[model samples]
Target: MNGPRERGRPGGADAADRALDDAVALANGPATARPGSRQPSTDPLVVALGHEPAGAGPAQARTRARQRPDAVAWPEARRLARRVGRRLDPRALPLGEDLLGMALARSLTALTDLPSFDSSAMDGWAVAGSGPWRLKGQVLAGQQRSADALLGGHAVRIATGAVLPPGTTAVLRSEHGSTQLRTDGEWLHVLASHSAPRAGQEIRRKGQECRGGEELLPAGAVVTPAVLGLAAAAGYDELTVTMRPRVEILVLGDELLDQGPPRAGRVRDALGPMLPSWLRGLGAEVTSVRRLVDDAGTLHAAVAASTADLVVTTGGTASGPVDHVHPVLAQLGATLLVDGVAVRPGHPMLLAQLPAGGLLAGLPGNPLAAVSGVLTLVDPVLRTLAGRPAPAPYAAPLTANVPGHPVDTRLVPVVFDDESAARPLHFTGPAMLRGLAAADGMAVIPPGGARAGQETAVLDTGALAPAWGSGA
Candidate 1:
């Protein structure tokens, strides 16, 4: 009763007729169906030719791909981000007291030699002769007295850091000399046990630590509290350092609440409150944070108008109905330097070069995924822009086995236990932040995972102050 099947048609005339009717109905349906319904076609050829299944379209396919991203390897994503960051020009900032965490743009040179003048190293008597000596006036620190030459049997009481008078010989420490009243004013008698003083004992000579114009710190040195002290001691009133990379954060989502608890499908904006401080820790100066609704035009305008060196967009990176990042980037002629990263919890993340000479980092909606994007892309970009050297790769043995993705790298939060091994923490799902909050660092697990006792690279999270010289 049924006619022969047409080419590309699996069933007979009845099935073919039904398929054609279904295709026609789909062509006439809404351009974008409900969230749960099949997505519409993004490919014009598929719609024009009407060859796809009744409900399946290019848009649907794209959306599915986004849900499970076709990503590049994690290392490649980091390289791309670093390359883009290195292209940015380094800006010089005045080295003020607030320069902590900034990288030195150039080598810091000493303006004056340390211990610019010969000074006493302890509270002592500057003696010219070896035996009993006549006492002269005292020399206190900062007193600009004349450099009177001392006679063969003369001595002057000098305090630590006091400039040594001309023609002074060995110094007699206070405990090593006895003072007595004699006919010729007061006299200082060196005790027999301490009579012999080394030629330069108790004296700090000029330029002992560093000479004038010597390099105190090299370029790319991170300014720390001790660096500030050293700069001051080296007679430097200001420093020339690389400026922190300026960043703008665009928090996107219609279902995000600015404050209060999550209710009725709306969750509090976690990234908004957390990103600013985190970016600062990464050497970025966050300029502003704007919460945006899911509007393509608005996002486009925001991206085009941003003047910051980098713009970080949170959420809407996928190809879902509410996801508008890709289309906007396409319209603006931006280059997708990193389409996606082969890393768990943040596989949908992307990095793009905005047409306006700025870079854009797209973070996924999930809390943990956003953190992953920060470590994988934002950290490297900001570090490079700040003129900081790439952190040396270091690894720690794993105390327990960590599950890994078949093709992607896994960044699992871990705590260092008593055995000095990184122990993986649980509750590290893409949407959760509990594990990250309790973790010290993230263990980078390679493909196929690692067994217990395997050495894995640990990414510092700025969670705790690093041990002295351990570099985290």
Candidate 2:
């Protein structure tokens, strides 16, 4: 099932390179100064293409902004991911440590047998042969092993997890015994109505649980509670784990206020409060958050001061009068990783990395659009940093007819029938948080796709798994 990203190369990365080169050329041109302003011509590409960066229409300026330059891999955004990932090693980190405590990323591998000792599966009498036997002393969990153990004509009481003393072959539960226990003067006697047990009956043989040196877990596994429990049982006290990627957030918008009521066209801050929780879910510790105005100078300073592995800026990514994010980013010599994805609702998504070692994800202004960018960009980066294995796709048939998209790949909210097999329940727009709340996951529809009771790939919330988990 392993394969490359199905959608192919990003168009935004390519677009950003061309735009940067053109902007650079314009910066070296004669019209390098802004009218009635002290700002160095930030968007030279717009000037050269016959437009003003401040008052230019988005369509025209964006068109002029495109000066195709040779594509360079490792755009600024990916470099951020790499920087964050550099602190952690996926393979050396133990699942136990990651799930149980705060873990720094390091390379790790399993070291011990999962189940160390051979034990019995049932509570019964232990006997060596098929012949009859007398009742011996009982052995329960935590009791010391018995010496001079004889099973030829005697049965010893054994409980689950209790070491089977030498000469024990079979375990017959008390329920199967005609007379389980009869108290005598100093010992509890058992009367066997049947012959002694045979080999391997109710007996967990040595190395059957696990060899002493066998591998209990693989590298790059994100530690969960059960994973930790397994490692602990395997006698591991410390585990190496991928260090959590550090993240930084910058909410850009003149209309947004960190606190206080909206005045006129302004709105309450949407990004600052929401980003921390989302980053945590992706296993990242958000180190800082900054809010910047729509001014190019302010935006440039914020980008320059950013110190996290990944810096996410909201608003000003698309073409707008106040949009100075792309221009400021170009000026910083940040490589464009992905300027736009071919997906609906999050097409304006921007990805880049500064030369100084950090990643940047530019999200659209709409709350829904920003959420899409987090899932599409941030989630995968965190996964890569943690060294977790790529997850297999979850498949479910569409509950209702889903509309097709001719131009862009679609991420549709879906609910599942957690009571049985996971079944898909499609919902409305990316903007509809209520609709997403009712969903168990996001279903991916390929570009130019249609569906009617057809199966689709789902990015499940993982809550759909049965409490015991799928046996697979």
Candidate 3:
């Protein structure tokens, strides 16, 4: 039935190619559809999985990272993002309450005005433009309004935050005034500044800095002290925010020990001491952390009963003989979201979704890889759990040549200029942790690579800078 002998090599049949195409076409249809089964709707999911197709298999992630315009490429990044979107939730709180308790656990809404009204900004005399007045009375903050009338041609001694009486348009500091007894029994003399005060001077007007209900902070903002104060000034008692994910850590490897004399070949666990502080900066509340030896059964039992919202396991994710994580995860039916990222020193890092509505990330045993995983994978997930937005990367001109493979997104440590402009410092491999500790932030070398003079985007460490002296 061959139409004609094809002029090609003996094994040149395109059967594999044809079969692949057919399989791809059928992948959009249900496997057990009957001959008379009706086609599903053209919507992506409907057409891809067919009508009534086995519970739509946990929302398919948009993992075509290569198609994205950005240079950094990590398959796990997108999958983790979608999983975070599905798992975390954000809510709002009232104005006036301090952002503590659960409120501190969530990202705050925007801020409003500080004073929220026109109030005196200093301890002074509130006077009208037509001075040469008599002493009317004195007013301090928190004093209730009384029948004391501040007449025209009179001045009132005012304390900070006091509401100005009608017709008073300016405030002259207390040092500028002279009060004296008048000859009349019922009068006291007041000499206001000879230069009549200007109207609206030293007054904080309502909505001057921020109006009522104006966003004092964008959504997904980390509630810092400044942000906290701003929110309070807006008259908010409480604010709705996204809840942070509860995390549990398990540091595995028989070569690790804690607080004991180091055995000949073993060492003290670095993760046990370092991970908690690192996790907090990502806004995650670590519920628990345990150390377990590399045993599949033991790890499985521990993970099965763990109730945390997320679990991070360190070491033992590779294919080495002692690597129990991969096998145990497989046995537990964990969905492999990311088996291995191409980034150096972090090649063994794994991101998987636990069957029980949470995520599991595995970091390599090396100190550098372990830290890299935190910055690249763990940081994003923790931010998601905290309901914070993915911060935009900071762009900077590369000061020198940064080397790396064309496919991997390299994380290089860097510092910033006084004006917050990022500048790369040293290049450290994934196995090198010294440079990372010295640098203030990490810059990403996007896939397709970069030259010494090209501009690059750096991720800044969100550390609070020291308060500088104003006079300096």
Best by TM-score: 1
Cα lDDT of candidate 2 equals: 0.57
lDDT of each: 0.74, 0.57, 0.59
The residue-by-residue lDDT of candidate 2 on 218-301, one tens digit each, is 554455667667666666666666566677887888788667886887788866887676666566767888787779998888
lDDT of 2 at 299: 83
Candidate 1: tens digits of C-alpha lDDT, residues 20-111: 22322222222223455443453321332333322333453344345546676675577668768663454555546578777788898889
Rank the candidate models, highest lDDT first. Answer: 1, 3, 2
Task: TM-score winner between 1 and 3, please give it.
Answer: 1
Better of 1 and 2 by TM-score: 1
Each prediction's Cα RMSD? Answer: 18.7, 13.8, 15.2
Best model per lDDT:
1
TM-scores for every candidate against the unseen true structure: 0.78, 0.69, 0.74
- Answer with 1 or 2, whichever has the higher lDDT: 1
What's the lDDT for residue 84 in model 2?
Answer: 45
